[model samples]
Target chain A: MAKDTMIEELLDAWEETYKKGQLTFWVFLALKESNKCMEEIKEFVERASDGTMTCEEQSLYRNLRKFQNLDIVAYDSRKVSKGPDRKYYYLTTTGEELFKRFVERNIMIFTKESIINLLTQ
Target chain B: MRVFTQRLGQFAISALIFTVAFRYALDLSVGMKSFPAALVCSIVYFGLMFFAGWYYGSKDAVENEIHDIGFRFHFITYVLCIALGYASYFIGWNTEPLRSLNIGAMSWGIGLALHFVFFLFAQKNAIRGYVKEEIFQ
Candidate 1:
């Protein structure tokens, strides 16, 4: 529960920090990990953080769509089984640059070791 | 919505406190009386946030927040660069000859252009409604 709250806080806390054109850092990071759809991204985040995701499925999809609008990320719909096509998303060049620049800027404060640990497992 | 807003409020308060402490310490050395305290504060704040994101991964809540804050600062800086460039041009300021060629505006405008190309134009078929296409086409 505490972890869930923390996750929620961290995700929502970023709203205050959205100055202009900026998307949430976590969303970018998640996209960078793989070119997965919303559901896959949600599951990945939960597994990565030991089921600590506090936001629901809709929020994840909403963020993805926003990223699409910003041209940071793009999606292609692949054929899924019965119901509908599954959209797979990947970071565009702009998205990659933004994420890279963001990391470079915070390299000193967040520490490489910590980031490595976080991304690796 | 309520919960999200509450969390955002908390983030704002925490950021305010951190800025105050950081500015106070920086003011001791830079002497805000002479130098532009506002400029110094903005620089230091961005420097710290950027440094944090670079050093620490956005694994936890605090680290993640720091990363996003850096993004906000960058986004704002680029916007301000373009805005102030236009402002200076219109104000008919003196220092430089070609006021039209604002370096900040030109360079940052390229950044914005790239944002449009890769993010907007990359996926040509994106705008179509998925459900609509899925059913019709």
Candidate 2:
């Protein structure tokens, strides 16, 4: 029974790891270069993806919040002239390192080698 | 529950495929006997799985950054253990067959436990990094 519990625990952990939408490399890439708010990230994604990719504000905000929870993303609200303050998101050092590794095998925005260099700094 | 079950099934199927390819690679490399070969194989295998998880896991609308962080945490811990094993072997401290298994196991357990708690509690906090102290302004 103890062994079974351990196994179950392992599965639960894996489930947590395997949860969907946890690897939005494009979103990370957008923020890695500079801190950005939701609109900025969305615009960057669209521009970078050339209209092929778009992340809705709601999804984007939720992703940013989750990343913040992991300490991979950091944010500070900025006041604008016309509206409510917006949260600008950027990759924390930890997030940048993780992004570098994630870029090692996958090509999301830049060449693998170039991205590793850019993200490492 | 349906979503969880569906996710479990998806993960199982993908994991099965990855295992098949990974097994073939190992068989071709060192026949699973040599320690270094096994070690390298495990690293590459897990690394590939990590990428695969990230790739597929990002499909849904809801994001789970904590989950991604957990994956990286375990992967890094595993890599560190492997590096330590290699370093110890080269330094003549021990053989290449993971002489200090307890170190790896203990370190990984500790790191993973800490990672679990950090992410879990981080989600519980009502506030995030953003603040308005008016000092910066």
Candidate 3:
């Protein structure tokens, strides 16, 4: 596949997810910036929801709480602030490494056809 | 219910927050006040309100239109109050010794109180509408 084709596919997927109103984009974007505490994540979620997150939306956030549940993400209550006990999540080293790989792979797959055609002709 | 009132509320809240924060940050009551400081703060606060309100308003037209309206009206009022307060502080400091401090303190107190009132009005009006829309929809 050409690099442009791969990029197009990724964008299409993103749009689809957005239309579905999934919480994944907000979570992913927030994690991209920094290792956020739970409070911080909640604030970002509230903001992204445009001050309107349905009960379902809130539940979706709760479901994202486990690392074993989603291998790419990890949560640690100990590393975060003490008092009243709250868990904080951050992308694992492997998760960060995988995200980079995912980007590179898509780019290579999309661009490969052009590169190959150029080389042969 | 009117669009103007809605917008007024938003602007009032933003202005209040900006004023209170600026006053606290500058320690205007205690410090040797500078005209430049007051002028800069007022400009920055109004500019922020305009830009933020516009950006948020564009997201969803009907909802934001009301917010923008409220914000604009409140902002104008806020600017006037701040300008008056700043001028009084400037004048007092130049004219009198101990009296200047008292005048500055009073100005800051009035500004801070006005800001708090605006905040309450904004939170009640601006956020409530959006929340209701989301819930009912």
Please list the C-alpha lDDT of all candidates, in the order they appear: 0.55, 0.61, 0.55
Compared to the true structure, candidate 2 yields what TM-score? 0.36
Tell me each candidate's TM-score. Answer: 0.35, 0.36, 0.28
DockQ for each model = 0.02, 0.09, 0.02
User: Which scores higher on lDDT, 2 or 3?
Assistant: 2
Q: In model 3, which regions exceed 4 Å deviation?
A: A1-17, A46-58, A78-83, A101-121, B1-137
Worst 10 residues of 3 chain A by lDDT: A61-70
lDDT of 1 by residue, B67-125 (tens): 13233333444554455445444555422234455765677778766664654343344
What is the DockQ of the complex in model 1?
0.02
Docking class of 3: incorrect
When just chain B is superposed on the true chain B, each candidate scores a TM-score of: 0.33, 0.44, 0.35
Measured by DockQ, the strongest candidate is 2
Q: Tens-digit lDDT track for model 2 on A1-121?
A: 6999999999878866553343276788888868888877888888886775666778677767666765888989889898899788889999899889877755456656878799888
Best first by TM-score, ranked: 2, 1, 3
Stretches of model 1 off by over 4 angstroms after superposition = A1-23, A112-121, B1-137
Which residue pairs in candidate 3 have backbone atoms (N, alpha carbon, C) closer than 3 angstroms, thus clashing? A2-A110, A2-A111, A3-A110, A3-A111, B7-B69, B7-B70, B7-B71, B8-B70, B11-B71
